[model samples]
Structure formats: structure tokens, C-alpha cells
Target: MDGNATIGHGPDRHPAAWNPARTREEKEEQGRRKEERSPMPPVTIMELLEKCKEKTALCDAREAAHRIKNDGDLVLIDVREPGEFEENPVPGAVNIPRGFLEFKICETCPEDHAPILLHCRTGGRAVLAAKTLAEMGYRNVAAYQGTVDELLAALE
Candidate 1:
């Protein structure tokens, strides 16, 4: 259809028609309807990173290892594959690989609100995992950046 032509089927609809006699209340109502239909702004990667940092729950691999060794309260979740975890993992870390994390963590963990420290081969997968966990209402979650090897070296 042409830009100036009305497309919808109704007596009240007119594409090129503008009601100059609309009252202030009517204008306000139309503005409200338009605002309600507008899409929300997209969240960027930088925003996510900053949020993770501000939450105070995010930690590096070395810090996570220390927490697991001393605090013993946080859940150490290795988001790497089973094969990778079998080769080596941080001491006392549970193997809930990235693919199965959503299912396994929610099922097995006793407390939905418990603090969890997640790590993958590197930081990338852990960030994604942490985001997922946070979205699922796990308030206290952290992502460990370093891989198993780096963690082990730091421990030594």
C-alpha cells in the first residue's frame, strides 16, 4: 500500500488523518500507549561485566580456590566438560559442565540462594554460566577466570 493510504480494516482508521481537535487527556493517553509498546533497551556485554563486578560475588580462579579451601561455604562448580574435569579440577570442585549446569545445579544444590563459584576451561564459559545463574535468581554467584592449570599453578 502507498504510505498515505490506510491499511487496516475499520471505519475509525485513516493513515493520513490527523485529529487536530484531540484533547490534552487524549494526547496523554496516546503517548502512554506508544511508550508502553516501545521495546526495552538492549543490555551490552560491558554492562553485564560491570554488573558482575559490582555484585561482589565474582572472583578469579585463585580467589575461588582460596574460598573453597578456607571458607568451605561456597559451591565450587567446574563448568568444563566431564572429560576435562576428569583430567583435573580444583580440589573439592564439582563437575557440572556448562551444558548441564542449569539442570544439575538447580536439582542438586540444597539452597537456591547459596553462593556459587563457577569456572570453565577459561573465563568465557564461566561468565555465561554466571549470567544464567543470576537470571535464575541465584543471588550469590561468581565466575572464576583462570583455567584448571592456572589455578593449580597459583595454588602451588
Candidate 2:
């Protein structure tokens, strides 16, 4: 884990390199080859965010609040940092930072089939969190692209 630490068995452990012993020139060549081999990703985070958002079940602020209020099987997750949650927490949401969501989701809600609604400061992180949960075999998931505060504000 040092500055020059490589993983497999070579000098280049920068994560993208396949062979560690390859020199810089060789590594650059290898990287180019890898790029040619694999398809490229979206140009920006917005594109990825859009994709994640499209793959999920969406709920506006009202629907999300209603679901949390009435659905016993629903779990509302606030994917914000501790400081953000403490400032003005979502009514029924459990604070789980986006970084730890993949690791902590199962422990927080073991019922895979139950609906889990995810939201963050804005819409982007919720889509991402929902996507991650879906990828991890969660059956029922929803992403409130609008934050809980947005919903509450509309009510007022």
C-alpha cells in the first residue's frame, strides 16, 4: 500500500496495469491495448447518473413521503454524510453515507424483497445508490431523485 506498491507481482500496481513488471512504455502500450479491447464509458458523470436514474423506480417527494409513512416494508435511506444528516435529517430516513452503502445495506435491511428508497443531497447520489443496491441483488428499490427537503418544501 505504499506509494509504489503494486498488486499482482510486478512493479506497476496502479490498478489499471495487468503486468506489474512492465516498464512505463510497456505499460502505456498495454493500457492502449486494453482500451481497444474494452468499450469506453460515458464521457461524464452526468451520463452515468442519467443511466442509473433511468434503471430505478422513481418517486417524487410526495410519493416518497407517503410510502415511508404508510408502507411498513419500506426503508428510506438518506445517503448523505453524518454532518448533512444531522443538520436537517429526513423524517424517517436512516442515515447511511454513500461510501458505506454497499457494505452496510444488507445489515440495515436484510429483507431483499422489501422496498428500499434511497435519496441524497440531490438526485444524482440517490440514483447511484439505487443502482448499487440493485446490482447487489436488492429486489425492490426506489430512488427519489428529489431530496426529502425538496418534498417538504413543496408541501409548505
Candidate 3:
């Protein structure tokens, strides 16, 4: 039976709007539109990192480490995946995976204007994460250019 075939139900009870299935012509039109749609340009991690470097603040690992240690107000975030973060954690950094950083950032740092720093397994992910934060209207966003291990080494 068709989705629009609601037995013993009037239009008011089971309106056409409630039908989930598309008509054959509608499905064909949708297929045509899908075929005509242009593909999205490929975006590599390196390309995203370059765009982030152009738009966001670039902080050396040593400088970021120094500021994080010396300053009390800066919010440091580790944007690596959970497994990687659990394996080796940054002492003062909060764990927010890169995928969820934008969604969870407000909860972690309520003030958009607050000083925030980001890092990941390497500089690439940090750059992208920092870019996302900056796009979200965060005032002071810094991306450390190295992994957590490298940042720690620089801090030493």
C-alpha cells in the first residue's frame, strides 16, 4: 500500500503531508537533482591547516607552554581523539575531541572572549580546531604548533 493510503482516515486525520514516501515522479526528479549536483572540492588536512594558519593565531609550542604555565586564566584544550588523549594526557589541558570541539566548547569555556589555546596529536588538527573556535567568534584563540609531547618537551 502507498504511504498516502490511510484506510478509514480522512485528509484531516492522515494528511498528504504526513506521507513519508515520495511519488514516482517526485523520486525521479530528486534523482535528477542529485545527479546534477556538483561535488564538493576535496579538502586535505594540510590544506585546512594552511587555511587555519592564515586565519588564526599561530603559537610556538614553547611560548604556549610558557603562557599556559605562567598564566592562570588561559583555557588549554587537547583536541585529539579520546583513545590518543587517554594514552597520554596533557597535565593542564581538557580533553575535547576534535569532532566535538565546536559543540562542547561553550560548555567548557562559557566566555567566548576568554583566552583559549588548542593542541592535538600534531599541529595540523590543532590548527583546524583553532580555526573552528575563531569562526565561532572566540576572541582570543591560539593553536600550538606541535603535539602534546612536543609541547611538553618545549616546556622542559
Candidate 4:
């Protein structure tokens, strides 16, 4: 036997395995299986923000305060530290730091779908808090991406 010769039968012995028709069908089947197993596409921040805008789900601290003053059911959540909240908050805002927001939001706002307006020193922590709330099944949540100084100035 030559060095390159087939070991057992012959080089073309597995004819069915190399058939183009079978290969195509196998590939299509694999693609179908993959499609079936693919997870739902993750929601993007822009989409979430857009939804917030559509539902009137987001507001700045001043807007939230005005709404609260005008018999709105919006819950103003300060996702910063207690010291920061004490330093300055939108009049009636509750101090629920970002770390404990997921656990405490339900207790503070019993309704699973209640509208929540969240704010921090800047927008970063508030966005994280809003995302956490959204993940926890809170349908109406928004982040105020402005600093305390900006909020105070706006209020004035």
C-alpha cells in the first residue's frame, strides 16, 4: 500500500457522508436549531429612554417635585448616599441609595408597576438604578442624568 492510500476500504468509501445534498440539509437543520435556541435581543438604553419619554416615565428633579406637588403618584428616589440626600434633595424625595434600591424599591413603592423617578449626584448612578428597577420588573422608571447643583439651579 502507498503512504497516502486509504487505511480500510478506499478514499471514496464514505460517499454518503460527503454528499452535497446531505451536507446542505445538515447545515440548514443546524441553523434552524441555533435560531430556536437564540435568546431574545437585549433592550438597549436608547430604546428604554425612548419608552420612558413616550410613557412620560422620566422627569428631572424639579419636574418630579412639581408633579408630586400637583397630586401625582410619582415616587422620587434618591439613589445617592444619605449624606448626599441630606445635603440637598428635591423637597420630598426618599433616600434609597443605589446599592439598596432593588431590595427597598418594592417596599417603598408597593405597586410593581408604579412610576419611579430616580436621581443621583449625576446621571450615572441614577441610570444604573433605573436599569436595576427595570430588570426587577418595574415597568415605569426613569433616570435624571443631572447633578445636584444643576437640579438646585433649575429649581431656583
Candidate 5:
């Protein structure tokens, strides 16, 4: 079709004729306006966490501590940032930030049957991380679904 030809109807039901050679900024502005006209509904953190939890296993701090004490092969991974881990570290727990988990997990825990326990400041990141590991084909993985303080207290 020609540059001036109407392609289809836009959100306003008007014949929309977007220039094929439109600048990037012009296309971005048009997309922003369209999104503003019909914004998507928000997804809450709790909702997302619950969904992730369903797809992965969950272990409380006390259970994790007990397993660590008994199971010599269990790998406890703290999925918090370096600064947070440095400030309040969990003994015997390795620091693998959530952002780097996918890249670093294989080297840290190669055996698929090895038990993995993931934790963060809150339950959200841990569960999400667990779900990711599960999807990555880890056989035994669990997220400590509690606050860091609770985990520390239980560990002690």
C-alpha cells in the first residue's frame, strides 16, 4: 500500500494511517498514548507470590535449619543482595542474588537431586527463585517463606 493509505482502524475507530517512516519517538508517543487510554490491571506482589508458591516447594526457617543439620547434601542459598547478606548473614548459606541465580546456580549446585533451600528478606523473592529453579529442572528445591529476621531466629 502507499504511504498515505489507511491500514486499519485504531482505538478511536478512525482509519489509522501510520507513516511507515515515522520516527522512533513518534511511534513511542503513540504507543504510550494507546496504553494510557487502556491501561492493564495491576498484579499485587502477594498474588504473584502465591502463584509461584504453588509451582514450587516451601520450607519454613525451622524446617530448613533441621534439614541442614541432618542432611549433609542440602544447599542453603540466600537470594538477597550482597549488601543485605553482608549486614545480616546466615551461617552456611551461600549468597547468590536473585538476579544472578540462573547464571550461578548450576556451578554452585550441579546435582539435580541435591536439596536447595532459598531465602530472602521477604518470602516473595525466595518463592520466585524456587519456582525458577523448579522450572530449571531441579528435583528438590524449596523457598523459606518468611522474613529474614524469622529465619535468623530459627537458625539460631
Candidate 6:
């Protein structure tokens, strides 16, 4: 469909004030009302990171390596960019960037009970990813609470 196409009539059709006939003042007022009705309070990134850390399981790089060595079914995920994963790839980890984790996880490990470990450049992204996976119904999930370098060092 064309981005500029509009197909319908009545107030319902022009609902979000996309009618183009509405005054700028009316649009601004609508925006203000929307903001006022927001249910969630603003949260800083640091606060969110801490909350994720608390909600998710976290382990050190050495612990992650130990688990991978012992648990053959464990899925190790390097939650970094493609370039980063290419530059310093973990021996057995699959590259799944944090942004695409949700979309691609089912393909990689469909079993909710399968052990999964996530790591990134720093612990922050891994913690967030671990929290997300847990919310997505993954029963066994853990984040490496250290940098990729640290994880690599531990693997050795």
C-alpha cells in the first residue's frame, strides 16, 4: 500500500487525528493527553539493568565454561554484534545478537527446559538477554556476569 493513501470516512477513519484537517494545536493537545495517560514511569538504563540482574540467574565466566563442558545439551549464546562475534568467537557459542534474540531463539533452542547460557562484551546485555529468555518461558537460563574476554580466558 502507498504510504500516502487514506481509505475510509467518518471520525473513526481519521481517529488519531491523521485527517490532516486537524489544527496543530489539537494535535499537540492530543499528544499531551497521551503522555498524561501513560501507565509506566520513566526508567533509566542503569535501573533497568539492575532489575534484570536481580530477576535473572547470573554466573561467572568460569562457571559458565564448567557448565558447558559438563552439560552437552547446554546452548551457549554470544549475544554480541556480528562483527564482534567474528572478531573473537567463542569456541562453541552461537552468535545471536541481542536485538534478534527473541526472533531467532526458537530456531536455535526450542525446548524450554534446555540449559542456555548468554554472554556479551559486558555482563549488561547478557543479563538483559537472560531475563528476556526467562520471560519467554525458558526454564533453564543463565547469563555470564563478565566480559567476553573474561569468558574466553576462562574457557582456556
TM-score of every model versus the real structure: 0.62, 0.75, 0.71, 0.58, 0.73, 0.77
> What RMSD does model 1 have?
8.4
Ranking by TM-score: 6, 2, 5, 3, 1, 4
lDDT tens readout by residue for model 6, 15-129: 3436565587788999999999999878999999999988888899889889978899999999999999999898899999999999999999999999999999988889999
* C-alpha-based local distance difference test score of model 5: 0.86
Candidate 5: which pairs clash?
A: none
Please, what are the lDDT tens digits per residue for candidate 5 over residues 1-156?
Answer: 666555456754434554545667798999889889886657798888878888888888788778868889889999999999999998899999999999999999998889998999987889989888988999899888888898788877
**Best candidate, TM-score-wise?**
6
**Where does the lowest 10-residue lDDT sum fall in candidate 6?**
12-21
Error of 6 at 4 (Å): 27
Winner by lDDT between candidate 6 and candidate 4? 6
Worst 10 residues of 2 by lDDT: 11-20
Give the per-residue lDDT of model 4 (tens digit) for 1-156. Answer: 444433236554553336678889999999999888989666787776555545434567677556556647878788999988887776768999888887788789988778787888877777777877777788878777668787777656
Model 4 residue runs over 4 Å out of place are 1-68
After superposing candidate 6 on the true structure, give the runs of residues whose Cα lies further than 4 Å from its correct spot.
1-24
- Per-residue CA lDDT of candidate 1, range 13-90, in tens? 756555556666689999999888989766788777666656545676568768777875778788888888888867
Show pairs that collide, candidate 4: none
Candidate 3 lDDT for residue 30 = 90
lDDT winner between candidates 2 and 3 = 3
Give the alpha carbon lDDT tens digit for every residue of 8-91 in model 3: 355556554444455666888998888679476568877866877998888887798898889899999999989998998888
* Pairwise TM-score winner, candidates 3 and 4: 3
Quick one: how many clashes does candidate 6 have? 0
The TM-score that candidate 1 achieves is 0.62
User: Cα lDDT of all candidates, in order?
Assistant: 0.77, 0.82, 0.84, 0.74, 0.86, 0.89
> Order of candidates by lDDT, top first?
6, 5, 3, 2, 1, 4
Model 3, backbone clash pairs (residues 3+ apart or across chains), number: 0
